[model samples]
Target: MTLKSIHIEDTDLQIEVKEVRKVSKIRYALKKLIYVPDADLKPKIITKILTHIRNIIENKVKEREEKDHEIGIFIAYKGKFIKGMVIAEDNPHYSSRNRRAASFGWLYAKDYEVCKELMEACESFARKRGKKLLRGPINFPKSVGGYGLQVEGFDEQLIYGVAFNDPKTAPSLKEFLEDLNYKQDSEYLSMEVTQDRWKSGTQLDKDIKIRYLTFEELNNRKDEILDILRGAFYSVLPDAFGMERYKEIMDLLRNIPSHYYKLPKKIKLENDSVQTEFVEAWKKCYDREVITFFHLAFDKNTDNLVGIITCLPDLYELWKDNPITRVNVDVAAVRKGYGRKGIFSSLNNIGQLTGNMLGITYYEGTSIWNLNEDAIRTILPHGRINRRFYVFQKRIKNPT
Candidate 1:
């Protein structure tokens, strides 16, 4: 049983750190924040961040206990006009946040000053404990949930299964984190997905055929697609190396539900052992029939599945009118030899046309940080780019 406490000046704010699981009331209170009435969520728009808070406390605590890390931090805030709270744990082995690749996710804070104070305490605690780096606003580990802050797109709100934050909060985060020599990192880029890309005449020749994947075929052929995904991504992306690291990758392929979410880190290794399980899980999580996948294969000469794309229809409505889903084309890939052939241009053209026919009014894309540069180029002729977000990273110890 270990604990600690702290206080701020001239305010009711006090922070406490202690260990206790199964806090039921707080969990219920948190649920309220998750679905706060949109009307009450006016002005500051501080909609109850209960979902994030609940994750930090309950699920994350279980993960820490499993990892056997002995230190945890908790804080409660009572400010002049706002009340907030946070919880974090010091456990590097905690693996469920995204897929366990994330070795650090600790120190939760709510408001500006308290967040700053909590980060300071975290830095001091980590320094005293002799840890290498401070890595998260992690919920527990990679498999669970962990998304830090968005330094780039301040105007964009988060989507389902993602974090939503205030723009002002990001600048403060930059100062606090950078001052501590902590680096910034991002997952994927959201590019303007337009319909005009088909102008490249990149579609497969009449000889090459485009086929929709049947559920049975999609199920049976998961391993092959997974293998290509692994091989194509591995050498280029060093972050996704081992099977455990690919757990999230597999999970993503299995459960994207048409509203895609990027992996915590890019996939840098080549191994597709878990693709079957991943796709199966995805099917269970999503029941929207309009969502579909198209896997492009070269002619009968070879059994190669070179070009691929996932298309979602009516996603704009699914997101409750959130513009992020206006029309999303994701997980697009094309093999090396197959490049320059119009495979990707063809896929984007047909995919967007299909989406438009299905009632999707807008088109969008979230590009992984290290994916094919050509795939992006192929989309240029089709649609207009609605947004462009940058990804940045700085190693903590390599500050120069």
Candidate 2:
């Protein structure tokens, strides 16, 4: 791919945008050495940044080879690399109109002025590609991209699976995007629930049975699981992945080895009762060290899948203690007819119970859209709001 370069007069910064086919190890090391300050925050902070950077490079290369999607990386430099962003063209399964988006992350800059120029370059690059609308801080897809900007709740530590930038940079980036006419497209709220607050109230109808997917079942019935996910989120997230892309993503996730996860061994309750049942459930479902948990609700009368909740071990925290202390609730969806039947609440109750049994202290749930009042209500009872993230978009004046 060709490298595109431009100069911003306002900041006197030279900007370059290019497709990242290969990232040199030396350059990667240099970035780590230069950008990371030698301070108390260096070790944990640097590791987080480096891990994300590596993922971006690898995904960009794979995107290029597939040729089904378009992705590019942009960098701002005066004498050296100051800012960077990633842009991609997304084809949602349900949307008829073509869409393009960009994610600005691993964002480290000297000042806000440089950040502004970097963002402008990203917008220009997207427009040149004939994109009508642009949305992000999202990497490649909503599932993997860690969507949104941290608009509120700055006092807390960053959680796993959620996107975050340097406290210094995040506020300025938000200000720049707002000033540049990027309107708020969407908002997601993050919240946490304590094990004590996770009380079970109403139960599902007698006909409805809650079931956990075994490792063998996950492999044999992967397609059904994907279908349930796509159907559940189709209305709420119209821009969800298409069938082909959905399968591709699942395949990638399924291939993850066991060692990457820290499995739950034993869970004890406040009553001093040992929860061996929870440990046995986990053992039955987890064939490897993968940290994903899936719970499905089935309607016996129709013998159909009605609801699903997916959770994964908070990788950031897991790696630190080598234990499943926290979990990130990735997605929770109920089929149309299944709504208002307490399926959503039941699934969460099960999640909390399972997590508690495994010694998990907290559960992190995100991407709860502002318009989703029902979901917000369901979560509010069990979790406290920790952070809010926003997606901004602007329409291009003229398409190619």
Candidate 3:
């Protein structure tokens, strides 16, 4: 009950919304862990898995580390029962409203009333930091919750890094947000692609060399490669996949903290993973040994990096103790002048061929935004939409 408070909502019922800032004070917080695969969800994750998910989020929220600053709020009914919960946090990588905003995600509510209370509570949390707008359902940037509420394509297979509602018993968060007047901020798509056969790995063009970059090459050419990336992505539409996250990663990729090198083993990104910092995110799937899948296209004559595609193994499979065979194609882009040429296709084809050679059987083309016509046209053709993601925004009233 450290920072508890009672408030009233604008609805007809005039219910009392009690806030609990400390997770320990509310033992009923874990009740929201129930799970049932709904109209769209498949292969329901049991309550233990949900408990694991809650632990990772709860620990990070409590730690309040550097750019990962976060707060978990529980909307209590009559000061006891847990009606709903939401997480408010600062995302330094977020590119919207000139980056002067916060995110509200890791959401849950039994009904619209609790959802409304949670959303407004997040709004108040935003304004206190001098922000006038808030956006999300981002959930957190890994499996379970990738970047938005699913609005379409529910019958398809679930992929890594895309957000999905854990418990189906509650009203859809998408509907609740719409009822709250939260407008669409961005739209994204995830597609399932497969390469049953290998393709020609021959250099597509005499001037364009497509090859997998080993860790040595990446470590050596990171500065030159990142410069090209910065140029290609800097002007990309904000809130889209071409987010400012790349710009923020310059230092993160360049300077690996001491802890990263000391990890007991290659950290599998899951509920037990404690690697929360941007550096530890190991988000960049650096090709090592047979894991060589990150493909880069370069100008043979100019010897300048021209295009790139990045990917990572689906870490969730580790939970089932199965060989990790699926991959998430997280990023793919060609420079401004490099478009329309076969550079992108060449790089991607080479990526697929090499991925299959390394025992990878499935691929999820993720984070392709609808607003980025170039991305949609290029990526959607590979496979049908597996899931649709959207970001929502609502204006926050200034704090008095």
Candidate 4:
């Protein structure tokens, strides 16, 4: 294990930062501490930690193989794992506006002093890389672990794939970052609505046709689906989603263990007269069973996919014997020119109907940026805000 020690001024404690490369070492080190509060869930939590570490390694390998960019991970330890972070030059070649930044997550510190030391370590690491700014707990990439810190609505249940910090630990971390002059760089909200509430009065224009796809269908037409996904978020988040990044995302999705969860056995359409092309496509591409839900909107005249919304069972919630009744809406996007044609509304209407038919009671919407007025307006009538998360950023003093 490679270690570096930095003395905490005016105190006897010294912070030790280590670069961990082996999954076995991480597992052995983590075994010494109780990372999760629930005894029943500790094993699963450890699996998740190991999985994240493996992903970081895989990401680095991909970067090297593709000759894309450079990235690194650091873990701060004082007898045990206190905090960990990842730093990267985020797709510098892809966009001129891309900032040199670090993504920090899996932060677990007991007190402000340790937290302060961890933040300083992160800043120093970024400075050494000639980074101009630092922004995180983004966990390497925003698509994998999400962005920002949860500052409000801690009483709510956790959403799948979204980062969760202990309520008590959250305040101290926030205060320490503020003390160090970090400011809120961005904010997102998570909202929730029952299937009944969302399905009551929602309607779509007659010209729009709603279609559903299974995991097999999605995998078969991966390129087309990826194009739609890219086009939808291109204007809003150009820097993040490229062809390479999209491939990484699809790889992660395909590796999920679908056999453990219960998926809908059949598609029960509310209207049988609706075009059967999507269903026929699914039949042709049907392969294995995977728990995934996709609702796509197409123009009846042009037969072009205009919008899409996807949901997956909350795996953590399902593991806890929660009946797997709630599905988290992971992505919702519409083509630029088709935004006002009720494409989004049509997708939502189908989403609710499908959820209800599958015995899903709740639908969770996350990563809803405050600047997205159209999305906010579309969901406001159906759901209420459950929680808010923020991303903090600070300018580095020196570039080199």
Candidate achieving the largest lDDT: 4
Q: For each candidate, what is the lDDT?
A: 0.43, 0.57, 0.58, 0.60
Global local distance difference test of model 4 = 0.60
| TM-score, one value per model | 0.59, 0.74, 0.71, 0.77
Greater TM-score among 3 and 4 belongs to 4
Worst 10 residues of 2 by lDDT: 91-100
Question: What tens digits encode model 1's per-residue C-alpha lDDT throughout 72-116?
Answer: 333333432223333444444332212322233333344456555
User: What ranges in model 2 sit over 4 Å off?
Assistant: 1-22, 25-65, 81-113, 140-145, 195-202, 231-234, 238-292
Give the runs in model 3 whose Cα sits over 4 Å from its true position. Answer: 1-31, 34-72, 166-171, 194-203, 216-235, 240-291
RMSD of each: 10.3, 5.5, 9.6, 4.8
lDDT of 4 by residue, 1-400 (tens): 3346777687676777666677776676555532343446657666765664565456644545335444444556655545443333333322212333544555556666566666776777667767767776664343334556777777776556555566776787778778878887677788886444343224455676765555566667667666676544434541233454455445545554554323355764335633343344234323545333667777889877778786756666656776567777867888777756656765665566555656667788877777667667777667788878877777878634
Residue 275 of model 3: what lDDT? Answer: 15
Please give the lDDT score for candidate 1. 0.43
- State how far residue 235 of model 3 sits from its true place (Å): 6.1
TM-score of 3: 0.71
